[model samples]
Target: MDQEKPKSSALSEKSGVEQPEIVSKIAAGHIVALRNKNVAAADLISGILSGNITALSRAITLVESTNPEHLAKANEVINGCLPHANQSIRIGITGVPGVGKSTFIEAFGKHLTGIGKKVAVLAVDPSSTISHGSILGDKTRMEELVKDQNAFIRPSPSGETLGGVARKTRETITLCEAFGFDTIVIETVGVGQSETAVHSMVDFFLLLKISGAGDELQGIKRGIMEMADAIVINKADGDNIKKARLAKTEFNRALHLFPAKKSGWTPKVSTCSAITKDGIDEVWEMISEFLELTKSNHYFGEKRREQNQYWMLETIDERLKNHFYNDKNTIALLEQNKKAVQNNEISPFAAAQILLENYFKFNH
Candidate 1:
């Protein structure tokens, strides 16, 4: 073959002519359009109600933003979308660290999507104090689910919220529901008061347990067990199957001793293997039965109404707290009062009363 002629480079030394001018121009136009696009609250609401995932994600980000303007817009978006929500099943999943929460969620989420159900997972990851940033590593853990087109996974920071949940988790759930996800799963930080906080927001609370030494159950608190609608023992395959079954029995006995739920639905216990994907359908079936019973008895709507009222009050309390604490004068007064109390110059009650009086005086 003849020797190949010298090929010209995209950047020609003869002249400053760009070879990919058209492609570069088109890319620049796209960047300009994206930068200039202003999404309005009404558009966000409409898009969310129409099952637009991008719009839903944007709305959720607004809700999580600490900026005052974003919060106002987020509230507007939420209010507009409220009428179109409440169709999804909100499930809260919690367990101790190493209980395989991510693995279980991956398996469960994939199963739901396989059956043609849209799934949204709101994962709350632990926050790092030094960086004030979240690990947000759940996406890495749930590799398969991350690839599922029908599934949406969002990992939020726990921040200073004692419950191991993002402050705007309920708002995120609302957006997910409006986006037409039929199943919304919230995975909380596996420690602290997360179970109770999750319990208040979700329709069904599923506690994941694993068989360990005789003290396997000791890690979980009694209040959390009482709040669980269903407790599922995980890692039930192979040699662990027998232990999981025994744990299931013990949990069942424990649940029976609690007072009956207001929904008149008794809690149940089951065994599952996220690795083997066994008994996952049975767990979902149990949830469906509970839903049917609650719906028939009208407790389903009743519980939602209660949750709304609870959240409304919570919002008001949080607003008041933020208002008080964000005031510069309030901070100065608090510091002064704290020092006085520490120095034995004033009683804690007196210091608190003075600060409250000052706070109200300025705020009012």
Candidate 2:
């Protein structure tokens, strides 16, 4: 699994000049510090490659950075670790705000662990600021799993995008698998009950819903319903038991409206009480059955291989966009061109064209 090592950290030294690594190190004082500011990240990346949990978390931080140099190294580290990746069941789970996504994950992850599966959770909520990392103390909420030796829970806010994924989530997924985690569960910041980007990259997409009778249907937009491979009426216990049952009936009726899934598994609408843990195994069985069905029919491997190609293109797009935006000259030109266009000195189209032209020229 040897990759041509990422051409040294030389690409990151600013000054608009690529200096020798020694010159950069001499100018910066510390060679080690010059690469990863998060000492934890280097250690963590090593752990991830070797299957260590603490190091895996640190590596995820490096991947999630808004900073440039860290991001470059993050890329190198994860790529070096990728041959060991893609071994897990990448499942994206989303639902409306009150759908108990965290609780269900805790239970589901426990079930995976009970059967000798290693599970990792990346709760994607992008609204979270640097000051606050994850949405809530789900680590506290899923206290049992948090402490489990076989489980690793990472709570990250879904970045300010509707894609239902946070920054660098793809890298985190890779890191999880490289560490020998076979089941990777990504929980998104449930957006109006629709599944989007996060689900697009996964092997199975699960949409959790609270059985709200007619009201529940209204909350879950039609688009999300269309994307669901499986829909579950969560919190199916106590007084809500009847409502959950009815919700399944309604969903089954509605699922019939859509075309058949590529995976060829009929989307099942089941009930589960994360609180009581009843039907937990049923949910697990449904997932296993779906996986077996897809894997047997060839969709499982084919879909994931397609996802890999998608990710390759996605990474190129993201990196190219970031490179252009981060080029200081590009930023300066963009601002100046924006004012010129606003003042009527230049047409908006010409101004944008200039930005695009200069971007390629400068980057080239």
Candidate 3:
């Protein structure tokens, strides 16, 4: 009888009444507020000018978007931000995959912020050929910098081509500058055409290398080395210190072989251990010297003017290319010609010419 009494449940039976909404009203209100948030150009411009990181990030996303409407709004935001931009130092850093570009940038960025400078790092991650997607893992790699209040780190996919990626990055730099970041660092995807793209946008170009990573001079690309304002030998601590100094000497000699840069400043080569934070200050001092020389000689402003002109022409070219490719008729013709060329029924050049003519005619 006691066992039977114990079997009776103390819990209440289920009610037939319907339950209230699972989400709390406060949370629902917050979500609705975010959804209905005003992202107008004027509001974004105001927020960006006041150093609102969220606004700056949203504006950058708008710039990177492919939507025509978003692009128009992005242009408006850029135009508004232009008056406040060009007041910051834009630095570009490039290196091979294993040269520790992310680590170097994180260390350098933290140093800049420590000196009371607001720093922004724009890291470009290479897109996969098959998936056309990027890992965008720079934020994860730069753990400390990402947590720094004075630092901002943004990693973007290196789109279909370096040109597209560079364009977006340049715009992002303007937004960051307008947001009061005095130091803007653009890290390229790798040591290739991306170096040139980044070089054209930044005031200072830095090339990072490591010692004993094969001959210091063997895999070096001439164009990249020429564009470099400074060659930094990273990973220079531990057993790598001596080798790094020797590599620096080799790079210094190699740098001398190239004609003097038009800026009239010799490219400096130095070694640093990103892990140990050794010689990082010298890197910034070197950059400061370059700035003093360039600014005093008026080359800094002149170079910026030239870059503006170059980007203007590039924008025109990109717009025309997009116009041609996005045309419905051109897309159709392109598909047909692609198949024809594959079948050897038509030469690639001829097919390209036919597509171009069709595009022009249709546009006219």
Candidate 4:
């Protein structure tokens, strides 16, 4: 018995994996909560701290949710995760419909995953101009890439914003980064002039286009070209080779006309075929080189800080709008004042003042 006891003690000493105290305690509490199928705020926080992707996704859904209770809990999770955020690269890709943005993204995402990089393809699809429902289904287009274990694809339905801004997308990117995703790609279904929202959020904006058509010069909206940090002519395969070549030249000229978006690093045009997977490496390399150059020149971090400020102001505007719309009395007053002005019963200036007074009275 004594010999057996010493042998057991020796075995325990050899395998002295103490499993760090903090980790064990957190896990023990989380396990109990999860086993009961009730993920509390603490469980969510601990899960996020350990970089559990599922927990992060669930937390984000809560944040994106409209339920008041969920909003409260989600805010807590966001606050807890805030300290661990902002480490990943934010890349925004925008192109008009039929530009092969999804195909290009699938190829690019697969390549990144193959190289041990985790890629999150966060997309904003254009909503119906009237009903405001998301039209382009980016997840359906990036099917193969969605199956990749290392790739996370989130398609955000565009809301009533003038642009297809998800409103929660910037928050989503920070959450993805906190979960250790190194590459964050935001795909905006280029719609009208509103697609400029992508430019304010990313380190670089990539404009994807199909190269073979002579329509290349007219295909991309002028504002997109102006905001683009790089243009990738996609589908450069098969019989499109010659046309792709010509299109590249056309874009090269077009790009030269635009003012430099990022200082010191001129935007370049590249070609790729998402089907054949040609030029994918070149595209990735160009991005890395551009990032290095911009970061070295100190524009990368500067741009991000400016973007952060933009989001703060944007949030303020959103909350103010909500404050107005959510007040039942304000809505009634707005209608009354609008009708009074429309009927000329009250002077336009007087109606405006009444609306403002009512808004402040309700708000204060």
Candidate 5:
């Protein structure tokens, strides 16, 4: 009886038997399709609305992707999520290098999380002139908030974009909103037109400044000043307190020169020490007031509508330019036209017209 004991499956090697293939536990209709990016757009949307961080991050990557397949998928996700967006408060923070934009965001973000508010920081880092690579090293600077469970920091690179904002920032905002982040803070790459770009997409625009950095007016452009909804003087601790106050007064005076805003809200100027965490709450309070005021006036909704239209036109313009430059025939024509124009055989406008005609013809 012991010698005739039934052998285990492995011991019965001589038996001719086939085992059924095992499927993955996680492999569902749409879940499996996610592996190949063939999942229906609604599934991705559902995942995001359910607060799945992985799905949210993946959707953002898709939104920023240049791959054709990912681009289509990204568009699907965006369209699906659009109805759920615009529920978050979007703040655009911009400052020149060394004004502690990173520090301020860190402290501000921590303050928000402390109050049980979910925060998302979209920090844009400057690309290196030599390597053309961005450090995207903001997380190191924002140590506390980076660790907070309610905080999500996404540092992106400013890749040759004139406005100091990433190309996909507006799209990224939508994804963050859908992820249930009630507050969004966008830190711009640099101090110039980046503010303008950020201003277009956000509900509030805050400009950070440092005292005694230079002639305060010279440090920020008049146009930039006009666009700011609030200006905060950072590093206002130790010996810089008096200087910061002076800068605050000077900024207030300059702000008065601009015509009144349509929102009927006067811009605010304050001083904050991000290191000591002083005046951070005051800044948030000001923002909350602005949101309340704008909401009451119905300007908040109107501004978002205007921004949507602006981005739509901007996207179309970008696509048209990309299409013209990416076409091989267009490139060839451009080279030939460059030579002709340099030799004075044809005017620049004439060469442009010829290239445009050919581009449209080929596409059509």
Candidate 6:
């Protein structure tokens, strides 16, 4: 045996057995189906109206897509869903980082669902400037609310828009309303221009703040304070309770300095412990009172009408900007002009004018 070593097996030799044709056929069929599965706009509308979460998610994804092919279908779905929308309360929540926004929203959303209301939370996650990706971890943070059948949580990335609010958030709200969700909660990425954007789209705006973080009055943006329908002081537990109350008082005083809101309702300040779930009910009560007052005074409807008009104009501006910036010639010229301006070969205004003239010549 040693002398006559067995013939070495060749590594390149093919096996005698072959894979079944049926298996390959099935896989090919699946691939074909997947490749051809373009959901119709009417189907998406019907599914959304029937409260299908999967369809709603797909429709929202379509709305958020930047692909030129999706625009028409997205618009069709949105138009179909429009008639069923504007029936839910749109609440926008914003806070600085570490303000317990996710925790508070989880508790508040659960409370809404517990009271027989279908709740939809559209939480905007901040995108990384380097990678242009978002963590999208709200579902993981709101463990309980994510598990609730009556509650829907959709986390969207805040793209390169002026505010950190998602560009398609308003459209997402419409789809949620058509899905039979009576309560819509929008959580902004963080405090900034985001508050203004979210405030315009929501029926009520709540600003969350933590106690003992810094001077309550110092570094606070007057615009945010004025835009808030309520300022909620979070983490109001343990040794922080007294500090939270003081902050609330300060906010209430600051709110008084601003002129009365057009809504004819005064902004309220409250403190709540997201950990202990303390004062969460009172927060809802405050919002309820606001809704009652606004509806009775007809400010609610008027505000919504004004918002619709604002969004229409904003859409036009956004489209024009996109068209100009996305053109190949414009992109090339912009880079050249940028370099020229940086090198002092041309003035900034002159570079801008050249780029604008070129863009208009091609576009017009």
lDDT of 4 by residue, 237-324 (tens): 9999888888888888887777666557888898889999999999889889988998899998899889999989998998788777
lDDT by residue (71-156, candidate 3, tens digit) is 78999999999999989999988888899999999999999999999999998888888998889999999999999999999998
Clashes of each: 0, 7, 0, 0, 0, 0
Each candidate: what lDDT?
0.88, 0.80, 0.88, 0.81, 0.88, 0.91
Model 3 C-alpha RMSD to native: 6.3
Clashing residue pairs, candidate 3? Answer: none
Misplaced by over 4 Å in model 1 are: 1-38, 213-221, 341-345
Where's the lowest-lDDT run of ten residues in candidate 5? Answer: 6-15
Task: Kindly indicate the candidate among 1 and 4 with the higher TM-score.
Answer: 1
Q: What value does the lDDT take at residue 250 in candidate 2?
A: 83
Candidate 6 residue lDDT tens string, 1-364? 4597677676555579664666587789997895468999999999999988889998999999999789999999999999999899999999888899999999999888888889999999999899999999999999999999999999999999867899999999999999999999999988478988898899999999987887766635788888889989999999999999989888877887889889999988999998999999999999999999999999999999999999999999999988889988899999999999999999999998999999999888
Worst 10 residues of 3 by lDDT: 1-10
TM-score of each model, paired residue for residue: 0.87, 0.81, 0.90, 0.83, 0.86, 0.89
- Candidate 2 C-alpha lDDT tens digits along 1-364: 8878767584476677665665564557674564455564456667777766657766777787788777667877787788888788888898877789989999998988999999988886546455644455678889989989999988776655455577678778888889898999988877653266776678888888887645755844568877778888889999999888988888888888888887788988899999999888998888899999998899998988888888788778887888888888799999899899889999999988899998888677
Error of 1 at 267 (Å): 1.1
For model 5, what is the alpha-carbon lDDT of residue 329? 81
lDDT of 6: 0.91
Of the candidates numbered 2 and 6, which has the greater TM-score value? 6
Model 2 lDDT, full chain set = 0.80
Residue 242 lDDT in candidate 4 = 81
Would you list the clashing residue pairs of candidate 4? none
Candidate 2: TM-score? Answer: 0.81
Q: Worst 10-residue stretch by lDDT in candidate 6?
A: 11-20
Best by lDDT: 6
